[model samples]
Target: MLSSINNIFGNSKKKKTDAIQSAVVAYSIRNGKLTVLNEVPEQSVKNVQAETNGLVLTQGFHKIGGSFFYFEEPGLYFFSFPFQKNSLRIVVGKDAIENALLISNTIIRGNKDDEQSLKHLKKEVLDRFLVLTCTYACIFVQHILNETGIKSRLVMTLTAEEENQYNDGHTLLEVYDTAIKKYVLVDIDKKCVFESDNGEKMDLLSFTGAIKNEAKIRIVSAAGFPKLDWAGFCAVDSGFNFQFIEQMFCYDEQQQLNLYKRICNLPVIMADNKYFSVSSATEVKNSWKNKLNFLPVEEFRQKFYPL
Candidate 1:
């Protein structure tokens, strides 16, 4: 999301740069008064409308930040002014036209203290402003593509090292790929095998028997894993199924072959074969609890006081 926002606003080519740099402003009005607004310099004022009352007012952009007054109705009036030299604008209206003018003058021509007050007012306007403009381009696109929909699914493969090194700072694609390849094979609406990083490999039947007999398996790593390094199988049911395979091979061909053989001998149950790479088991467990939003008290006890 951050990357997408940056991409839309960060390009530096002359044409795209000009388009982004072009000012975008916002505004809103309520209860027969203008309340929230933004003022921009260089670019044109694209559109304006009232959100609550359905009253509409339209105007063009001015190069300088200044004041403009107009009458809307009998005993009612509108006033527009810029907040800063090149920032947003604030529009205010009132039934008492004379009082409104006095306040507007005090704000626009007042002393340094008054200027400070106006700056605060401008900040408030900016903080609360909402977009009142609607473009026909978006409407047209929505209308044309109303019937079509997009669906996608990903099956990732990650390594043990990658699993234990989890960080949201990485791209979604990177994380997805890492999770699928290392721990579980994700598929749509189908039961798939889950692999664990247990010290020794065993067949599925033996693995299930051991897990059923022991009830719990201990995850131990003498070489500490990175913070947030954990792995799990997540199955998403969203009406789409796609499959892709990724293989990892190293320069040491003999070592790679031996590793492959070991993996091939592993158990098949989703729970029995799972392993997490984490710097501290307790911390990782707590983090997962907070993220997943529900931790059984029994699980909590096991996390803090594991036998």
Candidate 2:
């Protein structure tokens, strides 16, 4: 059934007023079956001839030549090869020249149903979607990291969010969380940090401080705004950390301005100010390695280890 459809509408050609031509290569699937339809009209044939004549004449040949006679019609036409059960549709118009050339080539090459062609198309679509998602996520994560003044490598986890909907596949998120000993607490005014294993309190000095030398940290939020939050953090980590702090805290040019500011803002043993920090670096790193065991880390090992 699909073969028949492809035979009928797999290729279409159309002509334009300027004598240029356009062609459509399309196929449809329905009810687990595929069909190809002819979408070209008759007018395209005349256009094809005109274009061919123009090209040939431009080369300084008075006599029109080479497939010039094939553009007699001005609309769509259907044709079937000898011993072929399926019929193909071609629209002839000003656009017919290019369309004709393409259809002719397809006929000669015999690649209409090549496995490589299908695979190429599928890969193109997948690559496009992946690029779009990654770009958006990167920007969003950077922004959040800058605002929070946290420094940590942001790695994504592929975890299923919801079940298949309307037969579509599940949704996933690239995520990272701090180790079990690492804990974080935040308030409206300032982000408080604490360590579960050490019982020590460390205030979040800046976004860069959060992830700079530290191994990892857990991201916590209500269930919504996944893309926005992730993009914010990624933006900061990518480069905007110090710039963000400068905008929020103005200071004169000093060699140790950032460090000075952090120390100045440190919270005393005051009430109503909460603090959040990680428990232990070793425990956090181990937990993350266990959770992300499926990642491609062989390259990481090679880079970190020379021999």
Candidate 3:
């Protein structure tokens, strides 16, 4: 047991080197004003002061960090700056993005886990850590993808909880994989993507469907993390006919694998443009108690887009 934990630690990502790479700075409007998070602070803003080409920043801009000027505004915004060191020749296609997950892989993983209280770090996780908690890695990678013009959403996978156990719900990303022509789930914290035995990538709903139909599915490495190291960490249904999927991205000798396995009827909410914002955090959603509104996805789409 100790050896497995030590092995995972030994296989974790190495620290960063002093090479200049691209930059990603995130902002949210706090107290009716634009404010940059200190964890992903003003200093991380490299060279995005002005508009690039004709992109206009679409929504209103603000000077949260010291990197930009004349951009005073209020309220939260959900937009990502198209990041590139120089002129970015926009790729044209029905799928206008590629290599998003791979590009993010080079930037988001980190060895450090002090994400919440990382107020004092100069620059936190501009690149690499497989050991960071699921939520932290998801949020950072979401921003990086959005910054680079890839569409992604936050997905919370819930499972049945035991009386005294914590680690039931987990957060990961639902990224639009162009090759699949649909969204697929990617677990950056685990350095893996969920897939079926036939080599098709899977989103949460699809994964649940495969499990329901008694099909073979598995997790494959996104980076160089070996498949053998990550095998057998997940136990679906927990030896019953229930629709539960409990996976352990973290190394635990005690076998607390209930991280991000999926099941129907869990009914997770808050997947939208603001999915990455703090205002849409999972804990905040739990505070609504029973008054939260519910809607059918198909019906909701038909009513909203009745064209």
Q: Each candidate's lDDT (Cα)?
A: 0.25, 0.25, 0.42
> Which candidate leads in TM-score?
3
Clashes of 1: 13
- Model 1, runs deviating above 4 Å: 1-17, 26-28, 32-94, 97-307
TM-score per model over all chains? 0.16, 0.15, 0.44
- The numbered model that scores best in lDDT is 3
Compose the digit string of candidate 2's lDDT tens values, residues 269-302: 1113321122222322222323322212233323
Compared with the true structure, the alpha-carbon lDDT of candidate 1 equals: 0.25
TM-score of 1: 0.16
Candidate ranking under TM-score, highest first, comes to 3, 1, 2
TM-score of candidate 3 relative to the true fold: 0.44
Q: Give residue 267's lDDT in candidate 2 (0 to 100).
A: 15
CA shift at 244, candidate 3, in angstroms? 23
Candidate 2 vs candidate 3: the TM-score winner is 3
